[model samples]
Every structure is written in C-alpha cells, then in structure tokens.
Target: MRIVDTHLHLIYPDRFSYPWLATKPRLNWQPWTHEAYFAEAVPLGIETALHMEVDVAEADIMGETEFVLGLPRIAGAIAACRPEHMNFVDQIEQLSEHAHVKGVRRILHESPDDLSQSDLFIENIRHLPDYDLSFDLCLRDDQLYLGVALAQRAPDVTFILDHCGNPIPNGSGLDPWRASITEIAHNPNVVGKISGLVNHCDPGWTAETLRPYVEHMIEAFGWDRVLWGSDHPVATVTGGTLTDWVKATREIVSGASPDEQARLFHRNAERIYKI
Candidate 1:
C-alpha cells in the first residue's frame, strides 16, 4: 500500500547547523539527502513525506524549511518553533505564509521538564490554531502526561505525539506507557505516531518485539488519528534501516482491513497534513 510519512527528517548540515549531530556520531556522516531517502522509501511504497524539523539552529529554521520543501516527494514540513518566547507570533505569522509548512515542533525530549510546562509555552502553542498549523510533541515516555496536559489546554490545535511517547519496546515501561497512551489519546485532538521504535529497541529488534506497542498505540488512538513515519537515520540506528521498519510495519498490520490500512498508511496523513 502507498504511504504518507508524517515524520521524515532530512539533515543538510552545510545548509543548516544541527547542533545535536555533534553528539550523535552514528548519524554524523554525510547529509541525508532526498535521493537517499526516496531510494528506499519509494520502493517500499512511501508515496510522500512531511519533513519534520531536525531542531536546527534558530537562525537556520526558515532556511531548513525552504530547503526540504523544495525537494522531490516532500509533501510539506513541520518547521521548528520556540513557543516559549514572546516573539513566537511574529515567527508564526512569517511561517503562515508558507503552505508547505504544515506544522511546528520544539524538541522537548532533551530539554528540562519545565520547558514545556511554562505558562508562556502553553499560551504560545495555543496560537497555532490561528495559522492552521498542528504541533508535533516530541517528549520522553515519562513526559507523556505533560504532553497530554498541553494538548488539553489547546483542544483546538492538533498534537502529533511522536515515537509512541518514546516507549522502550520489549522493556519494562509498557504498562506505564500504555496508561499514558490511553490518557493522551483521550484528547480528541491528539494523534499517535507508530514510528521510531527501532531507536528504543535492541540492535536486533524484530517485528514481534514491537508488535504489542504498535498494536496498543493503534488501539488507543484509533486508525483515524494514527499516522506512519520513517524517522529515518534515527530509525536506522540499532542496525535497522527504513526499509526494514516499513516491512516490519507492513507485517504487523497485515491482518488489518483495507480501509484501516488506508487510514494508517496514507489517508489519515493526507487529512491531517492537508497534503
């Protein structure tokens, strides 16, 4: 089946400074260009991909957005934004003019807990509805409740929870992650993404290792609110390639009905990202 990847990240270091790459030696090589992604993605039926922001330097955010959206097979972008700042509206207004920018993301997983909890952060996030841009919530597993709380405050804004709340698949956090998944999915505006599990699993992770987490996320969010993503390179860590994850995902949902597969693989993303 054809797929719409809601969480694809492309890194062009020369064009943008990715401060995080310095620590991530595994992904510190040549830039991950569109050619490399579509080479495997197209063969595996990924028809389109939305460029998720890679937390580029503040000055390079707009440059990064323009770069990716100009490439082939890139349907749109989830640009970077610092919602905690008072000047965020100006950036939002500037970005509102770009149809290719479908959403905004501020990486909360590596930051301190209080970063997203501030009143200004929540209020700034609330402004997204004015521009029709959704928010991509990238937080740790234990921080799922924080994401839920933020989403609840902005009920009108759509929140895409990344990496199944960063669950440790085949590990001990399943019960807590499951609870948080249930709680977050209760917000009708939140959608759960079934991507990037490879990053949290063992180097030799199998489809079976990820089956329960994947199934539970779909159960919690339902098909209409679930979207597929490659999360390439990061997903490629642990010796797993994008092709492997795509194949594993196909295997996991092999029993699903055609309409259900359609919703997860592409249809839901089409409606959510307006691609």
Candidate 2:
C-alpha cells in the first residue's frame, strides 16, 4: 500500500536556527536532510510526505516550509505558527497563499498549559477555517483535554491530533490517555494522527508493545478519522528507525481490511491534508 507520511521533519541547521535542538543532543547531530530521509522512506512505500515544522526560530519558520516543499516527494507542509502573536493573521495569510502549505502547528507539548488556552490563542485558532487550513495539535497525553477544549470551540476547523495523543507505551498512563482520547474523539472535527509512538517507547519496544495504544486510537476515532505519520528523525533519535515504525504500524493493524488499512496508510491523509 502507498503511504502518505503526514509528519516528516527535515532539519537544516545551516539554513535555519533551531534553538530547541540544543536541549536535544540526540537530534542535533547534523541536519536531517530530505535526501537522507527519502533514501529509506521511498523503499518503505512512503510515496509522499508532509513536511512537519521542526520548531525552528520564528525567523526561519517560513523559510523551512519553502525549502522543504521544494524537495522530492514532499507533498505539502504543516508550517509552524504562534497564534498568541498579534501578527498571527499575517502569518496565516502568508501560509494560506501557498498551495502546498496544508496546515499549521504550534508545539504545545513542552509549552505552558495556559499558552493555548488563552482567549487570544483560541481566537486565532478560530481563524483557520477562513483560510481552509487545519491545525495539528502536538499535545502531551495529559494535555489532551486542552485539545478537546480547543476543538470544541473551533468546530468549523479540522484538528489533527498528533502522536495518538502522545501516550507512553509503557502502560502506566494508559487509563487517563485512553479517557482523554475518547473525549477528544467525540468531536467530529478532530482526527488522529498515528505517529510518534516510537518516540515515547523504550529501546526494546515491539509491535505488540505498541498495539494497545494504536488500537485504542483507531477504535476511538474510527478508521476514517485517523491518518499515518512517520515522525521521522525524532523517532530515529528516540528509539526506532522510520523503517521499524512503518513495519510495526502495519503489523499491528494487519487484521483490518484492505480499505481500512488504506485509510490509515494514505487515503485519510489525502482527504484530511488535501494533498
């Protein structure tokens, strides 16, 4: 089956400034160029990819999008944005003008809880539907309720929940994560992205180790509301390779019918991201 990787991050330190990489030594080794990514991705059936923003410095956000959209097999981009800023409308205006810029993301996992909950933040997020842009919610497992609140307020906008709500595969946080995901999925406008599980797992993680989380996500959101994502270099740095993640994801969901698999692998991505 052809795969549409909805969360590929291509880094270039020479051309961009990623201050966050300083705290993540593993991912800061060198630039994770598109050439290095596609060498392995193409063989694994990833025919197209959406370049997810790498949280580069504000000055380089648009630059990163422009550069990656020019790379081979990169179907579109999920550029970064700061909804709290007064210039957010300008940012979305510029991004929406680009045909290949499918959506925008603000890394809320490490950010303060109140950051996205503010009135101004919610107001800016509400503006997405005007440009026909979706928002990728990169929230931690515990922060999922905030996602629920954001999704509810912006019923007109489509929200892609990244990393299956970013739960830990170790099972300790399973109960609450499941509860939160279930609540979030109740919103018809929200979709789940099956990516980044490897980043939250230990080195010895296997397909079986990831099964529960993946299955629950699909169960909650149903097949049509879920899509596939590689989470790429971050997955590699954290625990596994893009190849391992693809294999494991397929293995876990193998019981589903071909149509169901197609939706998760590529079909839903095409509909959700409009690539």
Candidate 3:
C-alpha cells in the first residue's frame, strides 16, 4: 500500500511568512517540518510526497519551493502563484526554471468569489501549459462550480480537484456536491484529490460518515482520475491524525481490486504530478 501524498504542506515560520496561519492557532503554534512528518508517515507506507504550497507571502514563494525540494522524499512542489496579476507569465517563467516545481495553486477557497473569475485570472491560467505545469483547485463546497468554469476555460491545462471538491459532509450539501463533481469530471481535464475532508468533518466522523462523499468522487472521476493526499498538519487541526486518515481510506476502498487501489494511492499522483 505505497502512497504518494500529493498535498502535504510543510510550515517553516523561520524561512517564510504564512500570514493566514495567524488565524489558525493550532497550526501556527509550531512548525511542521518534513522530519516531524516522515516519522509517522513512513511507518504508514508513505514513501514520497509533493510539498504543497502554504500560500506564503509573495516574497517567499520561490524560496519556499527551493527549500522544500531539498528535503528527503519530497518528489516536487506545488508552488503558489498569482494568476490575477498582469506579470503572471514572468512568475511562472521563474517557477518553470526549477524542475521540482510540478505545478501551481492559487488558494481560491478563502478568497473572494470573483478573485479567480476575473478575465486576467483566466487568461493567466491558460498559460500553464507553456511551462508544463498543472493547477491544484482548492475551492470550497459552494465554490465547486467556479472550478468547473475554470476547467472549461482552460481545457489544455490539467486541474487536480483538491479535497474531493472540499465537500461539507454535513448531509445537506451532498447532492449538489455530487452534481458539481460529475460536471467537473466531465471536462476530461480535471482530476480529483481525496484529501482534506477530515478538516471539514465533525469530531465524530468515521469511514462510514465519509463513505458516500468518497464513493461519489470515485464514481464520478473513476479510480484512474483520483489520488490520495495527507493534508498533514491541517488534517490534524480537526483532531484527525495522519494515521487515522490513511487507515480510514484503506478501509473505505478495501474492496477495490489491487490495480484500482494502486491507481488511487500512487499511480495517478505519479503520473499527474510527474512525481
């Protein structure tokens, strides 16, 4: 059960500035270094990982990428980018110079709805293919349609839907989330990441609570289009452990064929991120 974690975030307050963590007291209280992560991860069959960007300050973006790629088992990094800016091409050009930069992500989950809907943002996203980069879409449950719209406009670029569209598994948003996921998968350009749900779940959530959401995503995107991620310290923010997530995922997909399991756990991530 080897895993390729596609959404692991490492925090380094000394090296970079993560202003958003100010509001997230739990995560901000300590740095989540690779050494701390791999101690638990290695035992659970996580071999390698891609360091997802933590939305560091604009000044520390490239520096963060360079720093993480040097860590052990970090196959690559998903660096942060500002597609809304006019100089986005220049930014990607700089990011493209580093072979470890597998893709780029602009945190759309917390930003204003129109942040990524602007003409400039769409135009900038269209340029990703030029640098051989993918985009990780981190939208909230309500903002799932925005992901579909962006995928439609940038058919050439690969879109990895983070957190199974970051669904709110509170029972009410299920049907609409399922519809949006199906629509997103229809584009052929978007893939789904099975991570981040623990943060959205209630304290009492279990594999059964997450079964429907996970099943719908796999059904819509198919095994080949979906991959697993730890979401690490963030996963721990909601009283969920990395080990618990891995074990729960293993339980939920226990009936799938080994080949199908391989695709979801590691194969798709290796191919999609070029890891």
Tell me the whole-model lDDT of each prediction, alpha carbons only: 0.90, 0.92, 0.92
Error of 1 at 241 (Å): 0.5
Error of 2 at 6 (Å): 0.3
Per-model root-mean-square deviation over C-alphas: 0.9, 0.9, 1.0
lDDT of 2 by residue, 36-94 (tens): 89999999999989999999999998888888888888999999999999889999999
List the candidate 2 regions with Cα displacement exceeding 4 Å. Answer: none
Backbone clash count for every predicted candidate, in the order shown:
0, 0, 0
True lDDT of residue 249, candidate 3: 95
Give the alpha carbon lDDT tens digit for every residue of 97-206 in model 1.
88889999999999999999999999998999889999999988889989988987888999999988999875665888899899999999999988888899988888
lDDT by residue (tens digit), candidate 3, 1-275: 89999999999998899999989998999889999999999999999999999999999998999999999999999999999999999999999999989999999999999999889999999999999999999998889889889998889999999999888876455878888888889989999999998888888679998888889989999988999999998999778899999999999999999999999999999999987
What's the CA error at residue 207 for candidate 2, in Å?
0.1
- Estimate the TM-score for candidate 3: 0.98
